[model samples]
Target: MNETTTIFGIRAVIEAIQNQKTIDKIYIQKGLSGHLFMELQQHLSGGEYNMSYVPVEKLNRLVKGNHQGVVAKISPVAFADLEEVVTASLEKDTKPLFLLLDQIDDVRNFGAIIRTAECCGVDGIVIQKKGGAPVTADTVKTSAGAIFKIPLIKVDHIKDAIYYMQASGIKVFAATEKTEDLLYSKDLNQPLALVMGNEGKGISPSVLKIVDEKAKLPILGTISSLNVSVACGAFLYEVVRQRL
Candidate 1:
């Protein structure tokens, strides 16, 4: 909450909601229960704003004054619709290139991937709405402002996004060690969606089934795998190389 843009009292936050301000997201102190809290709960359920429950220490760190436990943050970038991105990209004359992330939770890695994707001319990035890290100031700063320049699509289910891309004649490539296919062996010249999963679990099983191709980096070193962002750079630049 210390990183939040607006720190307000419970009443002030409720009033902000009532006044129809563009509240990006709201954080309420945990164990905050009462008529006012209940009223805020009902207001939040109406979907006018994004809200979450957090610890009281979080609120205290946000502000020194009596906050009464509520804070709101303004979103820096607008999210793109997954369906719209797929539809529009396929409609264009140029071949589409997408970077799909399954469950990446690291902010720095996410930002680095964005930077690489932008430099490599990826059309958009598809991230799981729930599991991905929040794109905060840290993300933007890490991306070196590439976050603003690139399009980001937050999807409820990543498999649905993959299916949408498949229906549009775009091939989906899953980057994982389990696959025998080497990255260079695949034809990256075609319209494609490259998927990279989280650090620990790799791609979720649900998303893995739909991937048209599974390719892995050629590991010649002692280490079995490269870092997620490093692998991402390799795959993205492979696309760039193929395109040229």
Candidate 2:
């Protein structure tokens, strides 16, 4: 995997943004103000940016060169188009399975889930543009290069993706404990999209209301919960098992 690219200096960051680079995050020095910085702000206006205001020491730690109080991390891979991926998958003869991640915040968990999805023959994985883990060097390493093998699509909202899936005639299911239905009971051999939620919150209430069905893993052990990535693997493999 290629190392995460860092663009520093106000002018350099502006150029990268203007070029439509997939920026993971941007760090700026607190109380920063200058002509060049103003230009960068103009470029950043009216957009969803994962920006943070930190001390110059933080900026220095982010990069070795003079950052001009600005540092931006660029994604190594281009994000896939949701419509294109969904449409293409529907055209295939085999049943298509898609994975929807609702604000998965851990990079390692995200990477592991990607690997699992690829292994299970998922058509693609959809993630929201914000309020989720940023793609970084750790994410790339944890996926073990499976990140490159799968189609990773981003959307402004998870619910929007859910709506699209429903309209396209794909069954949407949420992996949550709220339902009495065990995962094994569900008829999984169909075109489906599985929704997995944030680690601490589970699936959002708004999301839970819309999914066609909800299923849970039988937890016989004392612990009531499982890691999001592990749970995702179990849910995905059930789909694989049913189809075979």
Candidate 3:
């Protein structure tokens, strides 16, 4: 963890949260309680932040200063509003291409996907706020700074985002190995969002049910599935190819 990525001390953390700073998660010492902690808890009741209780020793290792039993990991990139992004993209009179990530927890994989999305002229990338990987320094490094170039929107849920996109007339395709629909068989030259799922479990059934289509890349080898980032690249480039 980078020291610059964290805000230590109770008052500082409270101020960061109150100021609406993008925070990935906050760590508080177990059994901590006080007027200040109570204030923090009250702010957190809004349910926008993620909190974890850890031992004081763990907090100590995270920071050298007096953390006052609280430490917050700040998100490296500011998240964009999905509705605003979609609206703006449509208003520009260009076909919007989006990548919706479901529970992509690996920072490296997330970075790789962002890199590919930016290179392939994707309009933006959407991810669930809670389950997706936090944009950290490692992510920026792995993305080779593409994280800053690409627009990233964090939503409350992937399924809700899918429905919102569909309502906006954006076709959503879920990339999965279980589907018989081949990726190349689809019409990618349109306003669309591609949904890529978890590295292990794949797209949740609920999300898959709502997607306009489920497309899979061909796997001629013994391996049944490609890595999430690799599959994402294939699908994105296919969209680029179709657009051309």
Best-performing candidate as measured by TM-score: 2
Q: Where in model 1 is the C-alpha error above 4 Å?
A: 1-8, 11-26, 46-52
lDDT for each residue of candidate 1 in 1-244, tens digit (9 for 90 to 100) = 2132564887887787787654656778888887887887877777634467899888888678888778876556777887787778888887899999987888889889999999998889997656666666777777888987878987767898899888889999999988888999989999999999998889998888889999999989898888899999999999899888
Overall lDDT per candidate, in order of appearance: 0.82, 0.92, 0.88
- Runs in model 2 lying further than 4 Å from the true structure: none
In model 1, what are the clashing residue pairs, if there are any?
none
Clashing pairs in 3: none
Best by lDDT: 2
Report the number of clashing residue pairs per model. Answer: 0, 0, 0
Error of 3 at 181 (Å): 1.3
Worst 10-residue lDDT window, candidate 2 = 1-10
Q: What order do you get sorting by lDDT, best first?
A: 2, 3, 1
Cα RMSDs of all predictions?
3.2, 1.5, 2.2
The deviation in Å at residue 97 for candidate 1 is 0.5
TM match of model 1 to true structure: 0.85
**Per-residue CA lDDT of candidate 3, range 1-244, in tens?**
3212888988898788778888987888999999988998888888666677899999999889889999998987788988898998898767999999999989999999999999998889988868667777778888888888888888889988899899999999999977898999999999999999999999999988889998999899998889999999999999999998
When 1 and 3 are scored with TM-score, the better candidate is 3
